[model samples]
Target: MRWRDTDKSSNIEDRRDQQMASAGVPSALLMRLLPFLLRTKIGRIVLLLGGAYLAFQYFTGGYSLEPSNTSGFSQSQSASNGQLQDENAQFVAAILGTTETVWNQLLKGRYVDPKLVLYRNMTSTGCGMGQAQSGPFYCPADSKVYIDLSFLEELKKLGAPGDFAFAYVIAHEVGHHVQNLLGTNAKVRQAQQATDKVGANQLSVGLELQADCYAGVWGHYVDKQLNLLEAGDVDEGIAAASAVGDDRLQKMAGRAVQPEAFTHGSSAQRIKWFKVGFASGDIASCNTFTAK
Candidate 1:
């Protein structure tokens, strides 16, 4: 949590000002109208006409069906970017820098630091449109991590607050980057393809748990080598890991706890794995795939 004085990372891509344009028709509305439109001849004719008009516009460069922004970057958002840089953005860069330092040393020249993107609302990513509602994520396709600062507020609402908690979230995404670097993600995807739904979910759980462990490993170095952890910092990290557990999230959403549907494991599983890595500070000991 003592990251204010740390160096900011140069790998940050700030896209907070580049807001996503609105789509003409919300996808949900289009889905709702689709069945009715397909059921009648007149409606079918209307659909055909609409499609033809859109295609013609596309070919003629008359209009675009894609989301469009009249003004590129809104003035308010551009101004807000300055405010973010003063604290939030700097904190992110510092945390990322620490991760880069730790992982680069841990991997011994094999680690390729992934770019971290700062965005607001939504943004285009290598994996597709990244949305804040989905929280932070690492896109292996692009070898980058995307985060919306708003998610920090969401984390606080989930009962995990403080700088170290946010650091843990960042570290977890970086852990995913490490998985991608080591080809663990690809192997997991291949295995998932060969399995049933429940089996696939189990694989996903293992993958997520491993990331949590990796985060703990990063914490280990940050605490032991850098001496950044303060009193109650570890608790903040644990609370964060627990807050986002699939089971806890499901319960919070008023849904029944279903381990079979869990992709990120339960609260206990996450805390246990994180502790496992922290206790050993060894990647070999962090493997969740073969663990009972």
Candidate 2:
């Protein structure tokens, strides 16, 4: 968690100043029926089916998409915003530099590095239109990671605080990029397409947990090689993992922790897998696919 006294990464694009909005089928399109997805049992089933159908439709040209490669991915941000933009940009850049260092070393001669994009409100990505509300996520379509710093405020409210928590957030998203490079994400996507709602959610949970494990592995690199731990940094990471667990989110949303509804793994599972990765620093240790 001791990330200071160094230079910032050039790969980050800070757009924290933009006055942007969503370009998707606006909330108005599903406002009335949206609550049902989080409410009724049948609603969740319908929601998953609708998502699958739409994905199929889009795969068949329901929406025109531009095929763009991110081999030389670059960051773009508006400088016309606020001080928070600069502050968060530096914070994110430093963490990304740390990840790049670890992954570059771990992958040795093989892995391809990914770019991280920092934006406010909303932005267009190779995967699709990304918004701040979804938290931080990696778009495999573009091989770029997107983040909204506002999520930090929400994190503190969820009982997860400190620099390591934010670092873990970035690491988890970057873990998706790692998955992309390793082809785990593509396999998951294929399974998601072929499976039913309940089974698919199980696969999604495995994928998310594996990302958590990868994030933990990143921490191992920083802690062992970079000497970055400052006492309670690991605790901060665990707190964040707990805060964002499916059970905790379900409770916060006033719903039951339905096993079939879980896409991300439970609090204990996330923490356990992350610890495994941190302890081993070996990708082979992250076989959440085979773990019970």
Candidate 3:
């Protein structure tokens, strides 16, 4: 990916692996937030099991993540801020700075940089208890991005590759940030609150698909302006889009593919949207609502 020497995103918040290992999360908030996730006994069991698994990982080595340059990080994979100093952190922030430049120029407005928070196990966010299990997410409340560096390895295992894949993930989250800025997320949330289960799921699919498109838009200029993409970079992104499709995840989970249960689009839809934004590099072209 040639990322070791390239400009890192200023928005990045790498905590480094060793320090993250020291930051074991507690369970009090999980108990408090249990009510939001379920109403049934079986659901509660699932939640408890997930929490226990996260706890085990926090203390052990599951959450360990290192930076792209792993010269000093050897204790674990978790990106720990305590063990890592400001230099590594700047590497991430530099990458984010590039994203801000690309997206701002693309969007033609002052780019509001989302603070990419680097934490171990769990951290306080404007949203509810932020944990590694939630994967990488954007909190609209505070306009911040969250991620666990261990998930970089997870992405590779899932078939998403290279630094571009990481950039795609960030851009996709930033896409959600774009939706928040454009009031698309609020509109979707409002419509969801007003609708039944299936209709709301449809809205979610649209929203997620649009984020894929937004990521592609970021990819377009990133290649044009920075010359960062090598051959097969775009293909890697397509592979990633396919990898995270609801259908693929469902099959991996050993569940029957239920279209209604899809929060993210199918493999075809995700790839199509990302490609749409990539080829066009126009925000207006990412109107999944109209296309649908």
Candidate 4:
């Protein structure tokens, strides 16, 4: 991918230096003790006292709930990490800027650029606490995308490597932002609410496939308009899409290929949809909801 020459996006929120912390008591520990606390009078008293103590501490600023730089690292190690993070941040910003350009042009003034946040380990989002284990995700509630760059390493481990592959991942998340902007996400949520588990999963599969298609649409423009793609770049994007396919992942986990359990469709489905959008470069042709 020819991204270094591209302009970096101004919408990036870098929170990689910070880590979320609990105040007074950890929420997980409190939840674990809740049932015991409610079962006995002494436990209830203890719980009440604990709650009062926490409240007093909070009011007096005895503990902080804000994200803090708590990493205990040597200066050399910190410097090294900082350098790598800076490079990765620049790459992310460039890709996001390309997406913003394409979407803004396509939407013709209706597109709102979504904020992309770079964090390490975990971060607080509009959708609640986002963990690195969950990979990258877009939170519609905040109109932002949260990503832990470690997932890029994870993608390499999943057999998809290269800059374009990473760009596809970012584009896919941005595709979800487009869905949110066009009200497609809300409509899908409403439809999901009206369906059973299997039906809901099917809707989820459709939604995910649509995002893949949208990513391909973005890829088409970037390659055609900006000349960002090089040899084998498209293959990397396809491999990245296939790497996370529901069926392929389930098979990797030694499970049966159950279409009913799929929330992101099969590898073939993903590749097909991506190709559909890439081939046509048309949003109308990318609709997976009504496709057979």
Candidate 5:
């Protein structure tokens, strides 16, 4: 948690001032088309299918309708938000720097450092359009991490407040980048395509749990070598892992806890995986797929 005085990464890209350019089918056109299509059974079915296709495209990084303009950078936002942005930016850079150091040593200098893109509202990414609602994510296609600083406030709203919680979020995204580097993501994608919906969801849960473990692995290095973690920092990270579990989020929204619908595993699974990596500090211990 004590990250302010640490080394800052140079791979940070600040796109906080960009503006999104509108493209693709407009929402108004869809609204108009929907009513007309709903007049007939066939038309209504076709419309539903088309909507589902669009949603799939949007989620899979294939249909970016908005591209951000790279015009300029400014600090014209709220003074308090501006201060938080500056601090969070520095804090994130420090975390990235630490990850670079740890992975370089762990991989024996073969680790490729990923760029972190800090944007506001929306932006164009290799994995389609980035939105604040999507939260923090790493784009394997771009080899970069995307985050909106406002998500820090949202994390606090989810009851996971503290610098270590924020660090865990960033580390989890970086974990995805690690998977990308190791070809684990490619393997998972291949496996997902060969499975049914339930099986695919289970595979996704394995991937997410592995990322939580990777975050804990980073925490292990940060605590063991960097000595930056305070007394309650591990608890903060565990709280964050619990907060974002698919089951926890579903229960929070007043929905049933359906195991087959979970993509990110349950709260207990997340905390368990994190603890696995934290206790062992070994990448081999993070094989969530083979765990019973």
Candidate 6:
């Protein structure tokens, strides 16, 4: 929570000023190439790395990939004020910087820094069109994390208010980047594609819970090495994990809480895994895939 004076990450891409008018539709060439690339084992790498580069360039105004005759978009400046001094943006950058430090030490020089993209309303990403409603996500294709500052307001609405809670969210997304580095995301995606809906949901829950544990692993480092956590910070983080549980969100929406429908695990499972990583400070202990 002591982030105001902390260093901010230079890897942050500020796209708040660039308003994406249409959902980023890929160029025809890219759409045709991706499927072909995804078919082979080695090609998956090219698919993620190369496809992402072309997609990012197309979406971020490198060139107009769409035809001029298409009715999809027009150029216009963002109406939202995209200021650097915005307190929330600074907080996000500082947390990202902290994650960079933790991950560098943890990965031991193998870590390539992932940029965090800050956008307002909607944006184009390597994955696809990013909307605020999707919350924060790590797009492994581009090696970036996409977030809308407005998501903090939504987090507060979910009863997870506190700077540490927000930090946990950033760390969780960064955790996904870690998974991407470890090839966990790719394995899960492969498994998901081959499984039934319920089985795929189970795989998703493991993936998400592992990310939660990774977040706790980062928390462990910050508390032990950096000495940044104050009293009750862990509680705030657990509250955040609880607030975003599949069961909790389903209940909030007044839907029947179905275990089969859960994608991010139950509240107890999330809290448990986070504690596991926090207690151990070891990534090896975060094997949610094999845990009961």
Could you estimate the TM-score for every candidate? Answer: 0.82, 0.79, 0.75, 0.83, 0.81, 0.80
What are the lDDT figures for the candidates, one per model?
0.85, 0.80, 0.75, 0.85, 0.84, 0.83
lDDT of 5: 0.84
lDDT by residue (tens digit), candidate 4, 1-292: 8888887787777677664444645555776788989999999999888778766775687733354455532211212223434678788888998999999999997999988888777666778668888999999999999899999899999999989889999999999999999999999999999999999999999999999999999999999999999999999999999999999899899999999999999989999998888887888887899999
| Candidate structures ordered by lDDT, highest first | 4, 1, 5, 6, 2, 3
Which of 2 and 5 is the better model by TM-score?
Answer: 5
Which candidate leads the pack in TM-score? 4
Candidate order (TM-score): 4, 1, 5, 6, 2, 3
lDDT of 2: 0.80
Scanning candidate 5 in windows of ten residues, the lowest lDDT window is 75-84
lDDT score at residue 263, model 2, on the 0-100 scale: 92
Q: Write the per-residue lDDT of candidate 6 for residues 1-292, one digit (tens) a residue.
A: 7777777787777676554322355443555676888899888997677657766776586744232443322222211223356888888888888999999999997788888888766677788778788999989899889999899889899999899998999999999999999899999999999999999999999999999999999999989988889998999999999999999999999999999999999999999988988899999999998889
lDDT of 1 by residue, 168-251 (tens): 999999999999999999999999999999999999999999999999999999999988899999999999999999999999
lDDT of 2 by residue, 191-268 (tens): 899989998999999999999999999999999889988999999999999889998899999998887899998888
Deviation in angstroms for 277 in model 5? 0.8
Clashes of 2: 1
| Model 6, position 2: C-alpha lDDT score | 76
Q: Number of clashing residue pairs in every model?
A: 0, 1, 24, 0, 0, 0
> Which of 1 and 2 is the better model by lDDT?
1
Model 4 clash number:
0
